[model samples]
Target: MAFSTPRVRAVRHALTAGLLAVAAGLSGMAQAQSSTPIKLLVGFPAGAGTDAIARMLGEKLKDELGTPIVVENRAGAGGQIAAQALKAAPADGHTLFLTHDHSISILPQVVKNPGFNPSNDFVPVAGFATFANVLAVSGATPAKTIDEYVKWVKTQRDGKDTIGVPAPGSIPEFLVKMIGDKYKLDLQAAPYRGSAPMTADMLGNQISAGIASVPDFIENHKAGKVRIVAVIGAKRQPLLPTIPTFSELGFPNLDDYPYYGVFAPVGTPQPVIDRFGTALQKVLAMPDIKQKLTTLGLNVAYEPQGQFAGRVRTYTQSWERIIQASGFVPK
Candidate 1:
């Protein structure tokens, strides 16, 4: 182990040179990543809940990322259009899709040619939150609980009791079917273009009941314009603790909550993925971000890349079975 002074100096010089080269490479990579503006694509209209969440995250992420983040809405086909656009975008870590479970997990099963497979076309950066669908009735309806609502529905003058759902083949629509089957009630799901119109119809008494996300009905529920009879989740939502969950109400099949996450194109670099995911975790951990999302009736659940990707796979499988069992025919 005896080495000459000259040999030791040579070894030290080589080590220093290698370390400097590595540091320079890393600096170059960081500069490249921050050189361009990040585009966060929302797969819904401007005023939709998903769009709001995307914009909120973009605002906070821009500060953490030290780069401009622009939110673009490409609304159509239940997020299929935006998913396809993300797939076509360059894998430079400059484009991301801020979407919910509908576009990522449910659409592939319901749409014959959705143009992109979430599990295959994109990589999960991070999952921000999860939200439950709610079953609510108009204030005019003389019912408060699910049991009472079932009775009132049976007594409707029309032979078919209609429940308005935000969209066709959505979780809310499937829940309407599951609830009807569980209680042996004659119920029909009336699919609307979106939650806003469905909620409007509910307020106008055009429909006896409506099924949408808690946020879709929270304000109206609080104002007494609508009554949230039950929420679709494992337990009662913290924002609406008074409303019972479907599991507690003897319907465990409706207890699944959908997720919201960020994704990038398939070939995005690992370093970029890590950087963005770390920034997202930091943003999700902020007190104000958590509070804001919670106030919107979302569970501030943050899952990193590995766990989020696994969740996406499991959710996809679950939805596949649920969609098939619901007898939904792809369009």
Candidate 2:
């Protein structure tokens, strides 16, 4: 109470310096925590569907955060490379995996030792896209529909004709077997690394038919190189109004359309997860994103963490049955 003016000024200066130090430390911590650019790792090569979607979202994420977003293509092994990379990432939310059901749902069923656990090693970020696969035949083939395709295969298979699948135990392979079994075709199913390679074979006459996402063949099929035998969703894809759904052809249960989603490495903080989800929701709502996906035959859908987790669990159960029913085993 009786301090001199100089003493009081010295105390005030010390207090001010301490406050500034604390403020600076907190600001630096904030920047370190979540303000940096993020890497969106895609498990497919450029021009692939997953890569395209990741780039679209990465651009929006960059805009929304004022940070750069890089989409690194880590192709091969049906996403095992990307999945394993995600498994080893820092889980700091600055790196994420953008993948389809194959890596998340089918791989566990396909590989005996996949090297990563999707359920325990990753946190669901968002599920924002779904692709309805179709059974397609080469234009050189005489099939116009799934029924026609099966019947024609019986006519011309002549002991051996191939139905190209992205890979055995992949979602596309499952669809191929389902339709083949349903129609009693028993045609050979040939597996490839990804849809791109499979489509190459289908178009080059190396394979007579293929089970692939609608987007994969929409252009070539329209141009007369390939044709959709049947779509695997319950209803017709809005993008391809002319393509008939499996249900429309009396297999309503072929409604299991495949989806794509993002997941951060396990242990990423909850706040970071929230930031990603919010930015992604805005991206998904963009008019251009919706239009582009639809035009490519992907139906846009978004689910936040909780719903996406539920879907992961729900589809886990469903695909186990499908894989078993389809007589597929990891080998």
> Model 1, residue 188: what's the lDDT?
85
lDDT of each: 0.85, 0.81
Model 2 pairs in collision: none
Off by over 4 Å in 2: 1-35, 250-253
Residues 102-129, candidate 1, lDDT per residue (tens digit)? 8888878877888998767899988988
In terms of lDDT, the poorest run of 10 residues in model 1 is: 24-33
**Candidate 2 C-alpha error for residue 73, in Å:** 1.2
TM-score of 1: 0.89
